[model samples]
Target: MSDIDTYKQQGFGNSTGFGARPALLIVDLQVAFTDPQHLGGGNILAALNNTKSLLAVARQCGIPVAHSRNVFDSVDASVWCVKVKSLKDLTETAPASQIVEQVAPVPGECIVRKTKPSAFFETPLADWLHQKNVDTVIVAGCTTSGCVRASVVDCISHNFRTVVARDGVGDRALGPHEASLFDMAQKYADVLSCAEIAAHLRGALPG
Candidate 1:
């Protein structure tokens, strides 16, 4: 059998189902990753486009939207930063660490500042979702192999139906991007394309 067919047969590509009133979670689509000139930068233009559509659809459906970014303190960064010797770089004051323009969080949207890969770790993400009464979470953004993947696992752990937009998340390496998506689909979350998510939002089953 072809590799693709073999994977499908093993349920490695099974689609995770969506649910009513899905909340949108956009993770770490920051300038550092989008600029191609900073640490962790990647080929992420296509991913951004996909996420733009997701954002529009979520707004059209009146769904709650939240965003996450990684920022550290200039004076005293998180322990992870100190341990990794990256404390001086990820300061909260750096514009490079901010979310990219195309998908920047609008005023009043919940923006969670994280010091680690998982959005829920040391952040208010879980309580915020609970407050919003979110049943499902549609996730989009960059570095699928890192923060995005971490966030997906945490989303599931929080008991939220997690949906990772397949094309809407990118990584510095194509291999990790593809491999991590496969891993997320197999155990952590539903990984779908923007089109698939749109269909679900429109009350249709995604292929």
Candidate 2:
């Protein structure tokens, strides 16, 4: 069997059933990755557009929206030094590390900054979602094979119903992106397009 098939055979993923109390979590879509010349850059424009659609629907349905961005301390080399090989010029206040303007978090949204891939790692996001009674988490963002995938797995491990926006998440490499999405769908999340997710949200909310 192929790697994805092997993963599924081993029960790495689960079904994509959504819950009544759902929230949205957008992963790292920072300027560094959006810009083609940056260390974190990729072809994620399509994912960004789909994520925008998901954002509009979440707002219309009164669902809580959360976002995560990677920020390292200026003087702290322990943050991402071990993970990222090319770690030069990646400071907390660096313009490249900021979320891209097109996908910027709005005023009322809760934005979480982390020094790691998993959104819940040393973050208040889990408690925040639990307090809000969120049973389902609609996920979006950049680099499907990295932060996005890690967040999905963490969400599942935390026992949250997870829905992955297929078009709303992108990768630096097409092969890895597709493989990650398939693996996530088979194991961690229910993978769907932005429109399907919006429709599902619309159906759950009252007029």
Candidate 3:
């Protein structure tokens, strides 16, 4: 049996269909994670491009949107600084920590500044989404095996239905990218394509 067949037999890979309200979280699509020159490479560029249309749909749908950035601070540096020394340079004022122009946040969208993998970790993301009464979150961003995955786990842990944009997230390697997608789909969130998600956003789903 194939891996998916085994997972199916084990009762995994079930869908957690979309809910009434949804929010869009573009996680860590910063310059540091998009441009191959600075800690970025692989298919991240394509992921960014895919997310642009999703983001546009979210804005047009009047969905609550938030963007995350890895903002490092010397005084408040987390354990990650030692593990990934490059994170040290992504200081509060560093351009690398800034969101890429291709997917920059506009006014009224929450800016979630994080230092670790999960956007909701020690961040106000949960509260913000709660206030918006958001029941679902559509995730789109880079380093699929990293921040995006972490955020998806945390998002479901927070009791929100989570949907991952397959084409909207990328990693430094295809292996981890595909692995993360499968793992997440089997255990944590609904891993759907950007087109399907855009359809849901356009009023085509359980909402």
Candidate 4:
């Protein structure tokens, strides 16, 4: 038996069905993380491209949408910053702080900012989702081993049904990205392909 088979036998893998009202949470797809010349590169390009199609469906379906960016007002002395000094340059006005154009937020979409990995940490994301009556969150983003994983755990913790797009999240390394997705699927969220999730949302919502 494979590791996945072992996990399934151990009762670690079970489906967490999605809820009626689903929202899209695009976490940290900013230039800093997406562009090849920036701190993160190469590996996440496919993920971002996949998200473009999913984002269009979400918008058309009127599913609540929110985008998270790693824009920080200050980063000095923070444990995260100490580990990755490149993050300090991701200030409000920095080019790297800007969301990539391919999946940029349209008017009325919530914009979440955070200095840490989880977007929900001291941020208005949870309250906003609550106000929208969102019972499920569909996630797409970069650095799957970092912000994506962190946010997914918190999304479930907030009593919301969590779903992650399988190809819509990426990392700088393939090993960590795949590992994080597997762990999340077993523990925190349902892992589905972006295409499937988008189709479900469209079918779930009325015309």
Whole-model Cα lDDT of every candidate shown, in order: 0.82, 0.84, 0.91, 0.90
Lowest lDDT block of 10, candidate 3: 198-207
**Sliding window of 10 residues with minimal summed lDDT for model 2:** 83-92
Output the worst ten-in-a-row residue range by lDDT, candidate 4: 70-79
Find the candidate with the highest lDDT and give its number.
3
Q: Write the per-residue lDDT of candidate 3 for residues 1-207, one digit (tens) a residue.
A: 999999999999999999889999999988888878778888899999999989998888889999999988877687888899898888888988899998889999999888889999999999999999999999999789999999999999999999999999998899999999999999999999999999878874335
How big is the positional error of residue 149 in model 3, measured in Å on the Cα after superposition?
A: 0.6
Clashes of each: 0, 4, 0, 0
Alpha-carbon RMSD of each model:
3.4, 2.3, 1.7, 1.3
Model 1: lDDT equals 0.82
Rank candidates by lDDT, best first. Answer: 3, 4, 2, 1
Tens digit of per-residue lDDT, candidate 4, span 1-207: 999899999998688888889999999999889867776764699999999999999998999999999876754237888898888888899998999999999999999988889989879999999999999999999889999999999999999999999999989889999899999999999999998998898788876
Query: In candidate 1, residue 156 scores what lDDT?
Result: 90
Off by over 4 Å in 1: 1-16, 82-87, 204-207
Write model 2 residue lDDT over 98-193, tens digit each, in one string: 887777888777788887788988899999899899999999997899889999889989999999999999877788998888878887889999
Clashing pairs in 3: none
